[model samples]
Target: MDINCTTYELEVLHKIADAADALKLPCYLIGGFVRDKIIGRPTKDADIVCIGDGIELAHKVASSFSPKPYVAFFKNFGTAQIKIPTPSSEGSDTLNHLQLFEIEFVGARKESYQQTSRKPMVAPGNLTDDQNRRDFTINALAISLNKHDFGQLLDPFNGLKAIQKGIIETPLAPDETFSDDPLRMMRAIRFAAQLNFTITPATFEAIKANANRIKIVSQERITDELNKIVLSTKPSIGFDLLSKSGLLQLIFPQMMLLHGAENVEGMGHKDNFYHTLQVLDNIAAHTNDLWLRWAAILHDIAKPQTKKFEQGHGFTFHGHEVVGARMVPKIFSRLKLPLNEKMRLVQKLVELHLRPISLTKENITDSAVRRLLFDAGENIDDLMLLCHADITSKNKHKVKKYQQNFELVRMRMAEVEAKDHLRNWQPPITGELIMATFNLTPSREVGIIKDAIREAILDGIIPNHFDAAHTFMLQKAAMLNLYPVQQP
Candidate 1:
C-alpha cells in the first residue's frame, strides 16, 4: 500500500532514501509513524530503520537539507535523531506557528533479554528482527524508503489486518514477548484504551499469567503508561482491562480494592470500582484535563476504607473524601506522579467533590458557597465538574433531580462568588499585620486574631475590606485581653 504522505513528509522520506542509497544501506520507515498514517491519525514523528550505521545516515540526510538540521546520535544505543522544521502551511500540525518533523534513525537489530531484567542485549540484525522486537503487531508495520522498492509495503506479521480489526497483539509469541519486556503488558492496555481496540483473548491471558512480571519494570515507566491510559478518551476501557489482566492488582492494588460490593441486611451500595470508572468516563466527556480525570478515578478511592453498615442505614462511606484526600500524596509518590501542584490539585478536588453534592441535598447558603469557593479556590470549576460526573446513578429521574439541584448549587456559588469574591480569595488581615496591630511578636494570639477576622468575613459578619478586618482584629485582640502597644 502507498502510505499517504504530505509533500513535506514525502520530501523528508525521499531525503532519507537518497542518503541510505548513498551509503548502500537498506532503510524503511517503520513503527508508529506507519501505523498512525495507515489509520489516518495525524503524526509529526517518523522512525527510520536502516541496515547500516544509522547515525552516519542521519548526518547524510541532514546535509541534504538546506539548513542542515542537527544530528543527535547515541553511540551506546546505535541511534540518531534530527528534527526538520517545516512551514505551518505544509506541516501536519503547528507548534508556535512552526512545525517540526522529528525523524529517528536506528540500525536494524535483534534483542534478547535476561530472566531477571527487561533490558535487552542488542546486536545488529535484519529488518525482520527489528519488527519482531516491537511491542505490538500494529506498531511493527513498516514502509520501504528504498529506490527500487520505493513506497513498498512490508507486513511481515499482518499488522494491517489487526489495525482493520481494531486489535492489539504481539508480533511474536505473547508469553515470550511479555516476559522479555514486561512493560509491554502496560503498553497493550494503553493501546486498547488509546485506540479503543480490543486485546486478543490469548494476548490478554498471557498478560494475566505474567502480571507479576510487571514488578520488574521501573515505577516511572509503568506510571508513564498509566498516565497515558488515564488520558485516553474513555480511560475506563484501559483500567478495566488492567483489572481483568491482573495488572491493576499488581500496579495499583489500592484501586483494585474498590472492586466488590457487599450486601448488609440485603442492602448493597453501588460497586465503587465500576462507579469510579463511570465517573472517570463521565469527567472525560466534559474535560480533557488529566488531573481532573485523575480526581474522578480517585474521588471514591477511600470508600472501601470507610465503608460502614449501620442497623438502619444500608451502607455509608462517611469521611471517605477526607481519607481519600490524605491518601493522594502517598499514591502519587508510589506511582511516581508529580508531588507538586498537580498532586495537590487532585487532592483538593477529591476533598471537595462531595461538598457541592451535599449542598444540592440541603438548603444552599451563601456562607457554604463562599467556603466552597474559598477552599476550592481556582479549582471550583473543576470541583463542580467532578461532582457532576460523580452522579452516576442509573435512575434517570434521580439523575435529573440531582442535576437540577446541583445546578442550583452552581447558581448559588456564582452569586456568592460574584458578591463575595471568594474564589482564590486572600484574607485581608495578614499575620504580619496582626502582629503589627497587636504590637506583638509572632504568637498564637496573632494567629487567633487573624483566624477570627477571616472567619467573620467569610461568615458575612464583616465586609471583606481591610478596614472591617482591621476593626474585627482589634475586637478579637481585646477579647484576648491584649491591647495594642502605643505607637512610638
Candidate 2:
C-alpha cells in the first residue's frame, strides 16, 4: 500500500507489529482507518484486529509508550482502547504537536445474527473472515500488522478499485448481506450521501428489496443515521436515496408522505417533499445546528393535511401551522428524538412559520411585529432563518420581490422591537400587585383584568412598564366597579 501513514500512526502500528511478533500472534490494521487514510480523510481512531488476545496486545502497546499510556479494556467485547494525546490536547511536550489518534484493539471475530434479532453470536476468526464480515467493500480493506509485511495492503474484495471509482458496494451478495443486518442498507445510503458517491445498481436494488427489514431496527439507531444525513453538507442527497430505496417510508413515513402533488382544475401545489429538502439544504448552508435544520424540514409539513381546493384559488393550506405543531410531538416520539426543548423549538417554528410570510402579504402593523417578537423570544433569529429559507420559488422576480418585502418586514420588526422591548417581553403588571392593591382573592375578576392588562401591553395602549401599567389598571378597575376604600 502506498497510503502514507502519519508519523504517530506509523509508530503505533510498528509497535503493534513488534508486539505481535514477540507474542507470535497475527493482526492487522483494518476497516475505516485504512479507508480514510487512503482517501486522505483525517481519522483519530484506528481499528486493529488480533488473532490472539486483543486485551494483552493493547496493554503491551500502551506500555510501549514512554509514559505508559492507560489502556481501557472491555472484557465482554474483547476490545481495548489507548489514547495517544499530542501536545495540543494534553499540553505534554513529550509528544509531537502534529495530532492525536486513538488505537482500538479487538479480537478478530465472526458473527452470526438470529433471524429476528440484530445481536450476533460471535467467535474468534482469521483476517479473511473478519474482512468478509465488513459492511462495505471500501471498509473491508485491511493492512498487515505482522512481522513479515507491516504495512502490506490486503484487498480481498477490490475495495481500492471501488474507492477509486467513487462507488459504494457490499463485499458479499447485496441481498444476503442486507438480510444478515438490515441497518447496512441505511449505512450504504448514508455513506453514499456523505461521500457524494453512487450506489451500485445491485446495491440499490437490494435496498429496495430489503426495505422492510429496517422495521426491525430500533428508532434510536435509525434516527442516529438520519441525523448524520441531516448534518451532511448536502442532506438532500440522502433524502433522495432514502426515498428511492423505500426505507424512508418505513422509518419516517411522515416525510415520505410529502411526496406527491395532485392537480385540481389545472392548478397544482408544489411537491412538498422535494421542496422541503431544498429548504433543508438552504438552511444547512447558513447554520450547522441540527434542530434548526429540523425546523426547516418540518416548517411546511402539514400542508398536505390542510390542503383545500377552492374554486378560485389553486390550493390553500389554512392553519397548517396548528396541525403541524400538533404533529411535531408524534413525529419526535416515533423517531426517538429528544422530547425536551428541542421538540418544543421545532413545534414553535412550525406553528409560526407562516406568520412572517403573512406580514409580507398586506398592510402589516407594528403590533404584529411586537406579537411575533413576544412569541419567538430568544428563538427570533432562528425563526427568521427558517422563514428566509422557506422562500424557494423558481420564479426569479417572485423570489427577488419576496426577499425585498421580507427585508422590510425585518426592518419593521427591528423598529417595533427597539421601541417596545417586546422580544420575549413581559407584562409589567403582576397579578400579585392587582390582588394586593385591590385586596382581592384569585378569582374570575383577577384573570379578566390580567388578560386585559396583557392585551393593553401588546397592543401598545400602555408602555411595557410599571407606572403606565398601574395607571391603566386603575381606569380599567373603575369600569369593573372596584375601588379601594379610604383609610382611617
Candidate 3:
C-alpha cells in the first residue's frame, strides 16, 4: 500500500534516498511512521533503516540542508536522529515559528536476547533480519527509499494484511516475542486500545503464560505504557485486557480487589471493578486529563477494605473515599508515577469523590455548597465531573434521578460560590492575629479558636468576613475564659 506522503515528508524521503544512493546503501522507512501512515494517523516521527552505517547516512542527510541540522548519534545503538525544522507561514526566522520533525536513522540489524534481560545483543543484518526482530507484524512494514524501488512497500511478514485485519500479531513466535521483552506485552495492549484492534488469540495466550515476565521490566517502562493506555480514547479496553490476561493482578493487585461482589440475605453490591471502568470512560468522554482519569480509576479503590454488611442495608463502603485517598500515594510510589502535585490532585479527588454525591442526594444547602467549594477550590469543576461520572447504575430511573440531583448540586455550588466567594477560601482570621490579640504563644487555644472560626464560616453561622469571624472568635474565647490582651 502506498501512503500519501505530505510535501515536507516527500522532501525528507527524497533527501534520504539521494544520500543512500550516493553511499551505495539501501534504505527504507519503517515502523510506526509507516504503520500510522497506512492507517491515516497523523505522525511527526519517522524511522529510516539503512543496510549501512546509520550515523554516516545521517551526517550525509544533515549536510544537504543549507545550515546543517544537528545529528545526535548513538554509537552503542548504531542509531542517529535529526530534528528537521519546517518554516512557518509567518515567515519569521525565530525558533518559535519553526516546527520540528524527528527522523531516526538506524542500521539494519538483528537481535538476540538472554532470558534474564530485555536488552539484546545486536549485530548487522539484512532488512529481512530486522523485520524478523520486530515485536509486532504490523510494525514490521517498510517502504523502500531507493530510486529503483522508491515508495515500494516491503511486506515479508504480510504486515499490511495484519493492518487491514486490525490484528496485533507478533512477527515471530508469541512466546519468544514477549519472553524476550515483556514490555511488549504492555505495548500489545496499548496498541490494541489505541487503534481499537485485537490481539491474536495465540498472542493473548502467550501474554497470559508469560505474564510473570513483566516483573523483569522496569517500572518506568511499564508505567509509560500504562499511561498511554490510560490516555487512549477508551482506556477500559486496555485495562480489561490487562485484567483478563492476568497482567493486572501481577502489576496492580489493588485494583483487582474491586473485581467481585458478594451476596448475603438476597442483597449484593455492584462489582466495583467494572463500576470504576464505567466511571473512567464517563470521565474520559468529558476530559482528557490523566490525573482526572486516575481519580476515576481510584475513586472507589478502598471499597473492598471499607465494605461492610448490614442487616437492613445490603453493603456499605463507608469512608471509602478517605481510605482510597490514603492509598493513592503508596500506589503512585509503587508505579514510579510523579509524586508531585499530580499525585496530590488524584488523592484529593479520591478523598472528595463522594461529597458532591451526598449533596445531590440530600437537601442542597448553601452551607454544604460553600464547604464543597472551599475544599475543592480550583478543582471544583473536576470534582463535579468525577461525581457525575460516578453514577453508573443499571437502573435508568436511578441514573436519571442522580443526574438531576447532580445538576441541582452544581447550581447550588455556583450560587453559593458567587455569594460567599468560598472557593479556595481561608478564614478572614489568622492564627497569628488571634495569638497576638490574646497575648499568648502558639498553643492549643489558638488552634481551637482558629478551627471554630473556620467552622463558623463554613456552617454559615458567620460571614466569611473578618468582622464576623473576629466577633465569633472573641465570644468563643470568652467562653474558654481567655480574654484578649486589650479591648479593640
Which candidate number would show the highest TM-score if scored against the true structure? 1
- Cα lDDT tens digits for candidate 3, 1-488: 26967766787789999999999999999999999999999788899999989999999999997678899999999999999776453344444326788899999999999999999999999999999999999999999999997988999889999999999999999999999999999999999999999999999999999999999999999999999999999999999999999999999999999999899999999899999999999999999999999999999999999999999888999999999999999999999999999999999999998899898767778878887898999998889999999998989999998898888888888778887898878769999999899897999999999999988889999888988888999999998999988777
Candidate 1 TM-score versus the reference:
0.96
Candidate ordering by lDDT (highest first): 3, 1, 2
Q: List the residue pairs that clash in candidate 1.
A: none
- In model 3, pairs of residues that clash are none
Error at 325, model 2, angstroms: 0.7
lDDT values, one for every candidate: 0.91, 0.88, 0.92
lDDT by residue (tens digit), candidate 2, 47-126? 98999889999998887887787899999999999887764434334665365578899989988888787767889998
lDDT of 1 by residue, 11-108 (tens): 77888899999999999999999999888888989999999899999999999987788899999999999988865675445433266889999999
Residue 332 in model 1: lDDT: 96
lDDT of 3 at 91: 45
For candidate 1, give the lDDT: 0.91
- Candidate 2 lDDT trough over 10 residues, lowest sum: 88-97
